[model samples]
Target: MGNAQDKPPGTGGGGGRSDQATAGSGARGRAGGSAEKAQTHKASEKRVANGRENSPAGGQGQQGSPAVDTSYLDAPSGALPPHLARLKNEGNHLFKHGQFGDALEKYTHAIDGCAEAGIDSPEDLCILYSNRAACYLKDGNSTDCIQDCTKALELQPYSLKALLRRAIAYESLERYRKAYVDYKTVLQIDTGVQAAHDSVHRITKMLIEQDGPGWRENLPDIPAVPLSVQQHHREKPISVEVAQARAARAAQEEVRKKEACFTLLKREGNDLVKKGHFQEALQKYNECLSLKSDECALYTNRAICFLKLNHFEEAKQDCDSALQLEPSNKKAFYRRALAYKGLQDYLSASSDLQEVLQLDPNVREAEQELEVVTGLLRQSLMDSSAHTPRV
Candidate 1:
């Protein structure tokens, strides 16, 4: 998460400064010192607590010197709404004290307060969500961290902090492609950012090692920030609250359309598979997966095509991804069994087939596969034993 340690500065936490100079000087100036003088001296011995300095510095100035001013105790935060400011202040306090859970709760309350007041400025929302993303990262909830950063980006796409946080979360999840894209976008927006530049180089090297040098050539383009929305805000200048609400709805609708296209692509992939066009089906499934990586059915279907093409390793990887998304998916287990069988891994094949059967005892395909694998294992063991010399 982008510099998650940079929390909003705490406010209203500085207690009133003690009148140090006056008290200390009076104690030192006392004459005929006795029990009362000693008691006064003891009472006057004070040090500013919590790192707060006594405002009016030094003792009452010499007769002709100018008086020290300590009137700026209530620091002005320049027109920030009181409720929102208070929430951030409290959240920052909790965050500094390692109370991340409580800090998140305070940040959430601030978000709700903004909504209730119809204050939906992307700038305001982005800060709140980004701060909350920091808390989620601290709590080791990278998924939620990504979600909050995404929300912040939807409001303010050019927010480098939000983009950086999202990239960090994606990297944590091993989604290297997504993280690389985000880092690239950050570099595009601000070429001077060393972190983004370093991240791009690091992730590029990793991608090369994982997928070979050609991987960079196939990477998707970095996404452009929607600065036009911010510009339009200035030009047309609708009520901020109304504009923010409208923007949110429009973004949601766009997401719905994207999901609909994802479903359509999946259906097309299924049709291609049915027609025995395994290569075309693979392409379609890949496209669907690009839009919805968490779809267990899509991954399983892709594994089916890989198996048809005799790409046992690729088929196993796809089945593994599907099972990661859905551990209970019998189809994934069965498909993986096929993959293992293709690779002549009778032991693993038998295990997966057994799991499939356990999940669905009525599955005839799994039952038959399990029997075949069991016999192969037994025959292989017997062959090995037959070749062994007596000891």
Candidate 2:
């Protein structure tokens, strides 16, 4: 697929939400603070095994184009002190070799080198801070990463690196307003910073035109999010804390509709099962499981797939898991009995059906099955009695 940046124009409608998502491994509950998930056509383990470089969002990094706003924060065409020059060369070398770890160390030394040498001008400090911020980002220390970028902004207000990195950080935090402000700042720095320009334009369109809850109290009337970023955000799970926070925000705004992405995913899995794509259906069901383990339907559906695949042991295990997560799931009990039956473990199956009837006395299938088993057990007892004759 083309890079997100290379995509043809899309109507920048709505605040960024997307339908497409990657599902992987067993789905976890949507506890909601910045939890990211993906779609799964392939098993997560298989997908990871076929992988390359790591990114924060758990995908391949996009190649970054040259910053158009580079001119916005260059040191004023003057000679740099010798130590600063040497530090710059060393840092650049490490960064170029993809040695982000060592490069990070070098940048830290460079920052210390500047302080010891009294090279603390705002413009110079801003550049140092920005370079170091990149190192922190490469390390996945986004909290510190954004702080450094903010420091760069304090020094060089128009610094594109600072603006963009701050936006990146805010997005990582799911703080759309602050991110939008930083993006907007890029435009004021220069209109030619087309990536930021394009990003700002796109984000604005998404917030205002593309998705709901697009407005922010912090910035000028910019749309505030990229279409692709919004699309990525859609269906993405957050830690419980973050989801609650976002829920609070939307509730106050009275904007977003009822949340059902997990339910939606589970429903899709059900549809897949109906088409007899057992493995594929399990993937979808497992994806839902990852989002909300408490979701009774996810476990039941996945167990159904296991049963269809004739993996009775696995089906029973899935039922056990589902019932633990949702004790009231009658379907789990019904299926657990069937799994036992498939394994010819009639006693266990009878116990399960007994539980099913307890949960739903009107279930005719459970009643009929229970009666049949009971009759067989009685006949066996009578036959054994006859065989023990005179003993």
lDDT of each: 0.70, 0.60
Whose lDDT is greatest here?
Answer: 1
Could you tell me how far off, in angstroms, the CA of residue 295 lies in candidate 2 after the best superposition?
Answer: 5.3
Off by over 4 Å in 1: 1-234, 387-391
lDDT of 2: 0.60
lDDT of 2 by residue, 303-356 (tens): 899999999999998899889988878899999988887887777888889999
**TM, every model:** 0.41, 0.37
Q: What RMSD does model 2 have?
A: 20.9
Scanning candidate 1 in windows of ten residues, the lowest lDDT window is 8-17
TM-score of 2: 0.37
Residue pairs whose backbone atoms clash in candidate 1? none
